[model samples]
Target: MEERTRAYLRGRFGDYYRRTELTPPPGANEREWGFIPWTSGPGTTMVRHRSLLDLGSIEDFLARKRPRHVYFSAGRYDEPSASSMSEKGWRSSDLVFDLDADHLPSVTLGEDSYAEMLAKCKDALLRLLDFLEDDFGFEDLTIVFSGGRGYHVHVRDAGIQGLEREARREVVDYVRGIGLDIDEIQTKEMRGNTPARVIEKDGGWGSRIHQRLTALSDDLKRMDNEEALGRLSEIEGVGDKTAKTILGAVSADQDVEGYTENEEVEINYEAISAGNIELGGVGMRKLIDAIAEETVSAENAPIDEPVTTDTNRLIRLPGSLHGGSGLAVRRIDRSDLADFDPLVDAVPETFVGHEISVEVTDGGTVELRGDSFTVEEGVHSVPEYLGVFLMARGRAEKGQE
Candidate 1:
């Protein structure tokens, strides 16, 4: 890491025990791990500024750092799947503030492009404002720069009260819309667990909308309740900013847990060409123009297990314990740091979705799904940082054991 980058991190984290890399835990050989978190693309999203910085205090940063975390990841860059966060299996309940697509950058070929990136970022802000109004039943939303690569849009009106991470994912997906893969992201930004904040910010409409939704409840007579429940669609105007509240007031209700399960998928290939690609019922995990990045061809990817290979694989994810921030590692161990690599790369033939389905029998059609891969590795070292979301909820309910 450059001095300036170190300084910037210091400015934000203020003297975190520094290590050059995250090595694997000693008892195990490193290659057995897979996934990396925190850095962005091996070549994309580099730390552009070089000024040394300081973060006075972590508590202050968390309360006022203004950057809301939405995802957690860790792993190596050298061997893409050799290690990752999910494999470590942890999670967190970050103050997830996702933005609309317009909020992202449209990096044109070579020129001083910060202006362009920020412009698109702002344009996405406007669209987000409208998005909260239409999909979320709110007329306002707040925007903040992530200090790093993206933007953080906060909707902290009382209406939401506060959402657990999994629920937040559903909200962001709803607000981001469908036709596009709204529920999944190829990289961490889509998950929003990275440390992010506004370069410049001021609170306004989003806050106002949030407050209204929070207080706007009614004591309806049974008949009135019946009537209101019948017109669930219009109650949104009564200032309900979230579907949770609106639906709670509605007649038909579904188990929030079952309805919002993470759609599971498995990606064995990575770095396929972009454009005109679709994954039937799922989204392409990370659709980069692989040819632009390297000479790795479709046939060059590793297939240790055939796409059609079959096995009674049983992955019993913590299903009963779901939807909570699992852990905030006090310090990333150094040996684990060696497992951390900044240059690992891989082509994901399939990136798994949230829903984990068991292949009932062998010899049935097992296909590779979703073309996803980190353009650069070592960005997110703890691959399963987001996997144990239940841990977060478990902590909160069980009182932080």
Candidate 2:
């Protein structure tokens, strides 16, 4: 960082420490806190056996060290040292979920790409939230925008505090939809002269399957018969004849019989027999498997599995600045999440009114607040927030004007 940038950051930290509310992790006195102070040459330094007595103590520490980044352990410890986990005598920990857009398929890192990637990340976070709340019944959750590429969900349910590594992995698997048996979730039944419809039961993964299918049905309805048939035929076991029959049945809103009251709705299987589509249970299984794959792919949130499973994970402290992004790690209220714009909302108020000149070293277009600007190899006067963000990214230098 340049001298001017460093000075600006230090000044911001001074204000932040005074104004920002800092909440120590549960069992804070027993957990280790890590800091990457501006004076620290390159890496973070872990401060152990050092407990903050109150918010004033936290502010005092920040004023003294002026760390570029702050983090605390997910796990509580008796020893609170980095030397050995076994010696630390680990206690209960929050179940942490890290959802990063970079982990999602086709995400690229650049200013031009950030908006789309952020949207993708928001979608993933919402899905994960649904899974956590509706499926797992977890109510005590904290959501934070990581101030860079993703969000974090911290589950602090008392009942889940004692969950072991394997149990944690099971929760991760459920969120990722890994090792889910499609057959167990969906069953196929034959109606006279109808296509074999995959019937989704109520509750569990069944609800998700139903949601996906309903969306798919709406999309399929928008397409012409031939288009619907073509898309359906792309599925592994769905032949042209079967696809046509299925499309016809779906288009006609044909309903299947034998489904219990508990079942949401039955897919019509009469289309298969009507079209003389001869296939065994294996073929039916394949079609259902295809639907399952589609549903999972569309709905599953991409999260760092290791982060969630690791018992001793250290998560970024909310309200601290992300060193790489120069943005505040913001704690988001559950109700405000849908409207929270990280790029705009996570910016420090200290950077709001000030404007700085910077020379773009790497060319790209970036949108800040609501305005978009094309960045190229030249000096530009921009909001202090943008200047700091560009400087942190190593894409811009302090411009000599």
Candidate 3:
């Protein structure tokens, strides 16, 4: 970045801090704070190992420094400002999960637009929430848009604070569905004369698989006999003969006269729950394995695992501006998350009311503030927010009036 561009952003950032009231994270004084200053050259330097005491007031420090980026450690410490890790007393850390659009397997880089990537990241966020809220029953959650690539979830439930790194890795494994075995989740029960392996519908992975099985069965029951058989055959390991047997097993209980739709549904559920699907030559185990694989692929959240495991990781401050995107690293209310558009909502209100001239350097299409347009190499007068965004991203530079 040019010196003029750096100076302009530094000045604007200071102006933003002057007007913006940022709420510090809980126990801010006990956590180590860090910021990257607007230094010259291609490489940036991180000014870290500082605590809240060292900065005096957060607002004053930000206005004075006008840093390129700001962050706070996830781990709380006794001596947060200590110059070395050994000197800083190790304490508990918040369980943090990061969902980066660049890391998501569902996203296709170079092909997916920024909007599409963010949409996919939101889906992953919801899935991660399911594990945190329903499966783990964790409350006191804080969700924030990282102001650059994705979202961050901070789980501050008191019970998890003191957990060791290994314990945290286990949590990461569960969320990612690593080493998940269908047999481990199933229970053996006697169904008539045969001992059957049944999935407990109480909760957890078993409940998820059961739900998928129930839905699949409902759809199959609505189809014609031939169609349903054809659909069943599409599943791996289920050949024509196996498909016929499985279909018969699912329909065998439907022999009663005047069976209602609800009754058919119940029968299907019973078959799945009791594990009584009599696949003549093929075993129900193979079918369950296939469905379990499908369930994991569909439900697992692909979070950045290292972020969750690292006890001393530095994460972006919620209200600070991400110098890379010139967007607010904003905290999001859980209720508002579904409607939140990062490109629109994260744009700083500090830069919204005016226009500025910028000379586009590495130009391309930019989608921001609910508008999408292409820019080619030239000097253009655009919204101040757009100009700031372009300059921060190094795609443009400060232009004279």
All models, RMSD in angstroms:
27.0, 6.4, 4.4
The candidate that wins on lDDT is 3
User: Native-vs-model 1 lDDT?
Assistant: 0.26
| lDDT per residue as tens, model 1, 1-401 | 22333223223222122211222221122112211112422232321111112223223432233221321111112222323334432222112243322323343434523334444554554555544655466533433343222344434345553344455545544444322231222211111343321111112222222222222222222224334334322442322223223323122332222221122222111111111123211111111111111212111111112110111111111111111122221121223323321111110111123321111111211111122222121122212222122112221111111
lDDT values of the candidates?
0.26, 0.72, 0.85
Q: By TM-score, how accurate is candidate 3? A: 0.91
lDDT of 2 by residue, 85-191 (tens): 78878888899999988888647665427888988899899999989988889999999999888999999999988889999999988888899886566555565
Cα deviation at 334, candidate 2, in Å, is 0.9
lDDT of 3 by residue, 1-401 (tens): 88889999999999999998889989999999999999998898999999999997899999998898999999999999999988899888999999999999899999998789999999999999999999999998999999988999999999999988899999999988889987678776676778866776777888888887777677776776677667767877766666655655555664433333333222353464344434322445566666777888899989999999998989999899999989999899999998999999999999998999999998888899899978889999999999999999889999997
lDDT of 3 at 353: 89
Score every model by TM-score: 0.25, 0.81, 0.91
Model 3 gets an lDDT of 0.85
Error of 2 at 105 (Å): 1.5
Sorting all predicted structures by lDDT, with the top scorer first, yields: 3, 2, 1
